[model samples]
Target: MLYKELVELYKRLEKTTLKTLKTKFVSDFLKSVEKPELLEVIPYLILGKVFPDWDERELGIGEKLLIKAVSMATGINSEEIENSVRDTGDLGESIALALNKRKQKSFFSQPLTIERVYNTLVKIAEASGAGSQDRKLKYLANLFMDASPDEGKYLARTVLGIMRTGVAEGLLRDALADAFKVRVELVERAYMLTSDFGFVAKVAKLEGDEGLAKVKIQVGKPIKPMLAQMAANVREALVEMGGEAEFEIKYDGARVQVHKNGNKVLIYSRRLENVTKSIPEVVERVKEALKPEKVIVEGELVAVEETGRPRPFQYVLRRFRRKYNIEEMIEKIPLELNLFDILYVDGQNMIDTPFMERRKVLESVVNSNEWIKSAENLITKSPEEAEAFYHKALDLGHEGLMAKRLDSTYEPGNRGKKWLKIKPTMENLDLVVLGAEWGEGRRSGVLSSFLLGAYDPVKGDFVPVGKVGSGFTDEDLVEFTKMLKPLIKKEHGKEVELEPKVVIEVAYQEIQKSPKYESGFALRFPRYIALREDKGPEDADTVQRLAELYQFQERLKGGR
Candidate 1:
């Protein structure tokens, strides 16, 4: 397809705020994609590329590169190309314009199918990591040649990993369903259950819409988060919900959904990204304990202390980030899998069931281990009880609690009043200062926002939880950046990792289950709370602890 096709779709998507239309537009484009060349670049561009690291000046420079490319091909001035591509932030469009100007005709003429798309992605993934820079560049260049003008545009943006698709995941799900002439809900279930587009296409083809509807978490499939609801303290959420509402303890561990079939374990995140290989310990534990051939459960993956208390989020994260010598890390960290709720068990779909019902099933069916256990449960009648529990949790050194309505059904991906979170002490934590960017507007010279993260057990690394730019004066910001510059380990696009030494307290509005962050949790409105000068990285909180906090709040809201 020509880049013009995608541009037309993007324009249409922007014009309509209607959920159905927005989804349809994406599905239409996905179906319309025809370039075999685009497949090589699209996945890397959309899923692998990182943009959060670019400075304003670097971003401007990247844009200038595109403008130059466009100007070289077209008679238009560089400024005009830059201006045209500004709102879209897509360099591919400039390329498409230049091509169109040169060709004087449309270049895209075929329908893009799922199989062709996947084939291209597989090639790209295969070539990644070990491929030389020139080889990668050639691979990219070839994709452009093969892509139609519209495909070229999207492919270009994809290569840059700048997917400004107006359509979100939910909208895309809806669009895919409509495009295939199936119910939106059914399509969603299929995607959630399998976390594989290949399965989705097969289901669409084999069972039609009904086949998709039948897609429940089975031996190999698991449901994904449809929406993530996060909050600060219960009081704030209560106000957001227009007075009293149930709440749950938001745990401080990795947010994971586990699927078991007999002895096999497959783990996925709220984002539906496959993470089975990342957290092998959790998988082994689930395999030993659950032993179910077809079951899917959602819970926290945390690290524990010698005293059996939860460790910092970083401990569990380290296991996930490292590839070599994982056996030792697994034993050292010893990840615990906390099973909270069941999405599917046996042949039944529990997502439509109430929280209490699901919990009952979860408790009755699954046995907890030292590493993989059930979250604590509590019942609260009034705000006072909730408050009391919240304090109790804090006294136990937990982040907070999650409150959930007993009657609420699992609404995947939607953050509603159904679940609420409460945290203790708006205070300090031993968090890693991931990167520093120039402050915008008034905060110009000094670092205003600092990206923060707790550790992931599986990766043995720090993934973003939130950014902290507050709590620092100009002098502190300048000193902090200068002090931490030498700690830089490596640069991946816009993100810079230094030795995980600079620990800071991040004041966030609330804790949320996130797919964007690799560790599976995010802080709402996270700002720099304070710098912990006296702590080491080892003293930082772990993923397990966060999971415990989230789960604790959940029990309270469930009236456990």
Candidate 2:
């Protein structure tokens, strides 16, 4: 198929704010492609990439490099391109505008094909070291020289990983379902297992529902970790779980998915990014603790001090950033692997198994020690017992407790009521930081108020929920200013717009309906809880979830 076809769809997608319309545009385009191989490539291109997040492949092309490539292609100076970027606040638009000024088109330039663009981008990402920069620049310039002005805009945006097409994973899942006449849940399940939409699309198109059913958990591929909903209290949690549940201590640390195949071990973070090379101690500990030849386990890695007491959560993050003298850092800040659940074992997928059965299987395989052990848990049918365990966890410097239903199966990537978390403080929502306002008075020169947003699955965008200016220490204000500076997209007066990369956990006194925010609901007296470095913008709380919580609060008030 011609690359211009896809570019036209992107143009339509950019014009519409409704997600259903966007999905229709994508599904129609997918249906038009007759080739199976092209079907596999289209999903990646729409997502602004050739590989999945877990593949660890990057284009390594910075903004300056992109400016140089655009200049070379359009016969424009770098200064002209840079000035246009400043005026437009977008590099892709600047490139498109620069290319549109050309008087004549190349007579020898051929029509760009889908395969040509995908292959060229892959080659650019694979380029490395020495003179690879020049090679990449040449490839990008050649492609731009052949592309139309409209096509060049999306091409540059895709290469820069900022397509801003408003097409998210949820929309793509629905589109695949519509195009292939399959169930959305089936597509979602396949996506959760493989973490590759391209592969899922190919299978759904070729093999249909049966092929999606065959998708199982693999040892090497990381499955999306199952998430939990928040419970108001121990009594509510017990009642919701049918008066019986397994209560486990909630540790404040990094969530890791460990995959073991004989001597090889790989660790993935909650965002599915590989971090095996950063934690050698974790690899060794998993190898020694589990006796199975092949398995996939989920757990938390908490840093501890010399006395074996758990350290602050931030201390554990230092390990992820270490590239030199890793062994020395490992010794200085040792980590304890607290095993919670198992997903796969011995070539058999355990996600279909019941929680209690999986727990028994996990307990049998792990040889618990000081450094590697199961999470402290208690099986209780009484709310009093669950309450006691919750306090005990807090006394031990842990977060709170997680109450899981015994009959519940592991539902990958679904945040249902099967598992619920109860903390001592008010309820918290994981929100995306959209922008910030500059501080005033003693807090001048730094950002003091943070504009928060929640994910709207229907719109495939972050909707503004509220702003937060409290619950941050002076130290936090200074650190956050440094952290958010690089993400600044445009500044207007004291308000700075951000790229929506940072996720923060926020606590609120109540949820109120308001027309002032786009989400139609806002958090009353919202305050910053902590920076959730472990999560991404996609993992933030959804608008639907917030509405559900508001309804639950109303029911509580009526019952009282």
Backbone clashes for every candidate come to 91, 0
List of clashing residue pairs for candidate 2: none
Which 10 consecutive residues of model 2 have the lowest summed lDDT?
551-560
Tens-digit lDDT track of model 2 for 1-560: 89999999989998998888999998988888888888878998887767776766678787789888878887888899899887887777888898898544667999899999999988998998899999999999889888888888889888867676778788999999999988899999999997888888988899999999888877888999899887878899989999899999999888888999999999888888777888998899889999999999999899997776678777777787676899899889899989999999998889989999999999999999988888889999988888888999998888899999999999999889999988876557989999999999999989999999999876679999999999999999999998776457778999999878789988899899999999999899998878887677888888998987887777567734
Please list the Cα RMSD from the true structure of every candidate, rounded to 1 decimal place: 12.0, 3.2
Q: Model 2, which residues run further than 4 Å from truth?
A: 101-108, 132-134, 321-325, 437-448, 458-460, 470-501, 551-559
Candidate 1 on 65-166: residue-level lDDT in tens? Answer: 444543543446767666655433345665676556543222543454334443543444455345433344443444444445566565555444344443
| Top-TM-score candidate index | 2
